[model samples]
Target: MYIPKFLEKDDVIGVTAPSAGYTEQVDLTKLESAKFNLAEKGYKVIETDNVRKCEKGRSSTGRTRAEEFLSLMDDETVKYIVSASGGDFLMEMLEYLDYEKIKSNPKWIQGYSDNTGLIYPITTICDMATVYSGNIGDYGMSLWHEGVKNNLKLLEGRGIIQHEFDLFENEYVKKITGYEGYNLTDKVEYEYISTNKAENFSGRLLGGCLDVLIMLCGTKYDKTVEFVRKYREDGIIWYLESFDLSAARLQCALWQLKEAGWFEGAKGFLFGRPCFFMEEYETDFNEAVKTALDSLGLPIITGCDIGHRPPRMTMINGLRTKVKFDGKHLEMRYTELDGK
Candidate 1:
């Protein structure tokens, strides 16, 4: 794995819209605030033109999005890149991405949700580490959340110890001033399928939103099989989350991945909070996960602080992570694991 250079003072951070962009006043205001925040931190921030354009749930054509992203990759001044936001059309931009250029010019690119369509493939194909976390606009909030702060620290090449947050915003909130903070209400309690193993374990990090990953199956962008196999000795820790997938669909998706030999060398699993799981069939999240993955007998952790929810963890894809979970709370320390 090729771990790209981390961000430094005065480094230019490029923001590009690979899936969707902003058009509304609220969104534009958020973008402006984010830019100001970065600029105040002594870092230069630049955004692609499409980041302010939105139409029919898309920022621009797939090729155009890819072109903008590549432009940043080719720029020597831009040391890091961030996705503007998540949306539905990012998968279309995969075909137009130049993987060779990205591999040659490695930079830290980060995003979550729909951006997984791009981030996941970049790591698996390019053999370079990528970030699966919040977008650039997440910094727009007036008060920075803990998760967001830790994310910045990690990007700055600093070591960070990530612990479970006391609370998480369980439901969505409407932003009035466009600078609202998280109203954390729910007590965080990470669920475990079986604590039957040890209290701590380590593995090379992998996985992202299940909603986006399932679609990449059988596609040319999917190099997951090769990725896991290459790092089989270190063991694989799969951290997965979902955005609106139901219980039935979740289990089926897990089964599909299992059948596809995607988890060939996986040592454990990490599940994040699902956003809008209907569970109409009365199949709860626990039952769905146990039915498909419990047989593997590896440690399984659910209800984690990740995904389309507020106060999420910054997951460095392809980095070796030492995870400490006493069943209720979780802590993680990241390190470079034999990238050569």
Candidate 2:
């Protein structure tokens, strides 16, 4: 794997809307605040022309978004690139993106949700690490949660020791309404369960939002097989989360991934809270997980505070990660292996 250089002080972060763009209908208070927060951190934040442009669920045309992304990656001054926001069909931009150019430049690209399409290709095809965290607009919140703060720290080249979140937002909020800042109203406790009482395990971190990951299964972008083959000895720890996939849908997706050889050498799996799920015929998240992946017998840890759920963890794809489930508390330490 090709790990890019850690970010430096005063480095430039180019924000491009490769998926969805901000528009007049959406409130700009948070976005403007996020920019201010980024500027206050002694870094320059640059938004491309289409960052704020919106039409038909995307900021602009796929070609235009791809061009902006390519230009930002090739720009020497811009050390990092983050998606403005996540939206539907970011896969469209894949056909227009210059993967060869990106492979040569190798800059850090970060985002989740719909941005999963870009993250997978950048890591597998281009062989570079990508950050899976909140979108750039999330930084607009005046009061940053510990999770968000940690995510920013990680993006700035600092290592993070992730433990557990005291509470997680059960519901999703599109436009933080009736609040001065981020309104994390509903509080739900975190429950981490391991299939086996495995105290410790290590592997290369991989995976993202299931909503988008499932869509890339059979496409040319599905490089999971090759990636797993190359890193089979090191092993792969998949940390997956759901955005809007139902329990039934999630089960099917998991089966599809299994058949596609996506989990050939997987050491373990970390599943986040489902954004939307149904207890179909007494089958829930756990049942779905068991029915689809029980045969593997790998340590399957669930109820992690990650994606779609508020107070998510920031994971670096292609980095070495150690997971510990000590009966009571679960913790993860992300690092780089010796000799790369």
Candidate 1: misplaced stretches above 4 Å? 337-340
Clashes of each: 0, 1
Candidate 1, residues 64-180, lDDT tens digits: the string is 999999999999999889998898989888989999999999999999999999999999999999999889878888989988888988888778788888888898887776677
lDDT of 2 by residue, 78-170 (tens): 988888888896888889987788888877899888898999878988778898888886787767888888887776667768887777776
TM-score against truth, every candidate: 0.97, 0.94
lDDT of 1: 0.88
Report the poorest 10 consecutive residues by lDDT, candidate 2. Answer: 176-185
Model 2 clash pairs? 34-140
Top candidate by TM-score: 1
Off by over 4 Å in 2: 25-27, 173-181, 185-194, 337-340
